[model samples]
Each structure stands twice: as C-alpha cells, then as structure tokens.
Target: MCIIFFQFKPHSASAYRFILAANRDEYYSRPTKPADFWENDCNILSGYLVADFLTEEADGLTYLKKVSSEGHLYNGFNLITAEFNNTKGDTMCYYGNKSGQEPKTLEPGIYGLSNSLLETPWKKLVYGKKLFTDTVKQCNELSQESLVEELINMLNNEEFQLPAPDIEEQGQDFIRPMLKEISALFVRTSSYGTRTNTVILVDAKGHVTFTERTMLNPDANQWKVSSFQFELEI
Candidate 1:
C-alpha cells in the first residue's frame, strides 16, 4: 500500500503554494529505481515513469480526466493531478475509480489518500493529514530545509491505529491480517515495508523542490537520499 498527503494553496500569500509528502510501500525484494529525470524528456522527473500518450498542450487535470474515463481498463488507483501557475493561480483534481465518483477539482486545502480512496479516513491517512496540516501551519516560520525535514519526519512516523471495523470487515480472508500490520504510517515487516518517502514543495515564486529518500538495503538498514530543485516554467 502507498499513502499521500498534500496541501494546495494556490496564489496564497504564504511562501509555498503546494506541499506534498508520500510513502511508497512495497516488498523489500521488489526491483526499484531511484528518482531521476527521464533521458527522453529531461523536463520531467519521477521515481518511475509511465508512458502516457497525450498532446503536449494537455495539462495535468486534462490528462487525469482522460485516465479516469479509461479507469476500468486498469487496477484500482488514486490519482491526483495539479497545474500550478503563478499568473493564473493553480488547479488540483482527484480521481478514484473505485469510489465511482467523477473527477472533480479540489478546493485549496489539505487532503490525504491511501490505498482505499481519497480522504477515506483510513487510520494512517487521518494521522498523516493531521501531521501534514500541522506542518503546513508552521510553514511560514520554518526555512525550506526545516520544512523538508519536518515533512520527512512526518512520513517516518510509525504510530499505528487499528483499522475501523467496517474496513476490517471489507478485507478478504487473507488480507485481514495484513491490514493491521500496514495501519502504521511507516510499515515494516520481514519481507515487505515502506521502501521510499518523497517530499515536494512548490513555492509562490514557482520554485520547486523535490526530494526522495529510498531504502537501499533493507536488511542492513541502508538508505539513500536524492534531491532536485528547479523553477516551474508554467
């Protein structure tokens, strides 16, 4: 399972217009690559690249809608797309096919998503949203480095909460046991656990900072961190 928490405050008076923190949980033995820019498209950067055929003029939200319309062809996923513009402000949208809800634009505020759905109130999602909100409230007081550190710490949180009864009941027979183990913000097990944590910040000036921390060797507890900073062109 994976988790994402974010705050979108377009055209706000504060320094940052967007803040995002996420954790990617997977089996330790799973083959993975670190975050980096694509060779074919140096303008884009991500831990993994998905080839999507779309016109260059299509924006993030547009691409999201296209994916939503074809959601039935793919497995369950929670996708959030955003377009940040200093002049025109910003736009964010959430689409969860499992919820059977149409793609909708999100208002400027904090939001969280886990394996279930958008703002599903899963134990980890609720806890992470609170941590995200608290960090955002102190954004103006913290430096950029401090802000990143705080967000990273929030992602590292291991606090756990039992899943709601309804949630537990919805799980398959074999999935029920795994549910309790993954309830924590940071999950760790013998074979599977959180493999990476990522934080992204886009300031009012259109400056973007992306940082990713990955587990290099789970058994030895080795880790690696990579960061990239750039100015948004649009």
Candidate 2:
C-alpha cells in the first residue's frame, strides 16, 4: 500500500500558487518510482498519459476516464492529479481499489489516503484528516521550498511512529491494527518503511518545481534531496 497526501493552493501569495506536499509510503520490498517533471512528464494514469487530455466531466471537471489498462493495472499507487490552464483544475484522483468506485470531481481542499478506499476508512482509525489540517495551518504561508521540508517532517513524526507503546495501552482490541494503520504515514513493517517524500508546486506563471527526498535504505535515516524546476502553463 502507498500513501499520498497533498495540499493544493490555487490562489496564494507564495511563489507556488499551487503547493502540493505528498509522500509515497510502501514496503521496503516495493520498488520506488521517481517523479519526473524536469523534462517530459509522461505519467500514464489508468490508460491515458497525464500530459495529453481535453475533455469535460458532467460537473465540469475536464478529464478522460479509462477503466481498463493495456496491461495489468499498477495497484501500488495513491494518486491525485490536477489539470490546469491543460485540461478544469483537470484534477483526478485514483486509489488502488477502483473495482466499483467511479472517478468523481473534487473541489479545492486538503486530502490524504493510503491503501484503503478514497475517503472511506478501511478500519476504525485513519489520521489523514488531522495531518492535513495541521500541516495546512502551519505551512500555508511558507514558500514552496520551506513547505516541502515541513511536510516531510510530518511523515517522520515520532508521536505516531511505529511500535508505539501508548497505542498498546489504548486497549489492544481497539488499537491493535488501527494504531498502526492511522499513523502509517511513515511505516516500518519489518523490512518495509517509507522510502520517499515528494513535493510539487506550480504557479500561474507556468513555473514548476518538484522536490524529492529518497531514503537509501529502509532503516536508513538519511535522505538525498533532489529539486527540479521547469516552466509549464499547467
């Protein structure tokens, strides 16, 4: 399972009018896929390359929907994509499980998700909402660069870090799997742990910046940060 959480600010005084802070959480066993926006962005969602599009939804959310993939669908993705001054906020999000859940339009707001369902919690505990609200309040006015660092820290918060004892005292029956699930923004399930943190920001000026911090090993505490900048209308 993967975790992708972000904040979208379309109108702001910051350099990046659109600020997106997100992390991709998966087992150390899962392979990592780096983001690319410096050169060509050829992200294929469902079936269509995210770069190519021109369509409108019933509610005016312009996007092309593809239910089937040319091959097997990649299931380890929790993605939130937007269309800009390319396709209506051209925003489209897809959780790994979409057997019956159809794509729907979304208004501007903060959101987060893991392996479970889009907004529905798989278990009794889900902490994305609190993380979203807290981060937004603290980082809303920060520059794109500063905002990225702040979000990464949230993922590595020790308050809810794995193997927590406080959770156990909450009553084993109540917090068993739930404690781990809700605070799983950063996970270390034996050999699996968070591997990367990414932040993407764009502005009305057609400028884009994508910053990534990758862990060398599952247990390794260090990260190599890479920042990419380019100009695009969307």
Clashes of 1: 0
lDDT of 1 by residue, 124-184 (tens): 6787899889998999999999999999999988877775554566556744667666778
Candidate 1: which stretches are off by over 4 Å?
49-55, 163-171
Clash counts for all predictions? 0, 3
- The 0-to-1 C-alpha lDDT of every candidate, in the order given, reads 0.82, 0.54
RMSD of 1: 2.0
Candidate 1 has a TM-score of: 0.92
TM-score to native of every candidate shown: 0.92, 0.66
RMSD in order of candidates: 2.0, 6.4
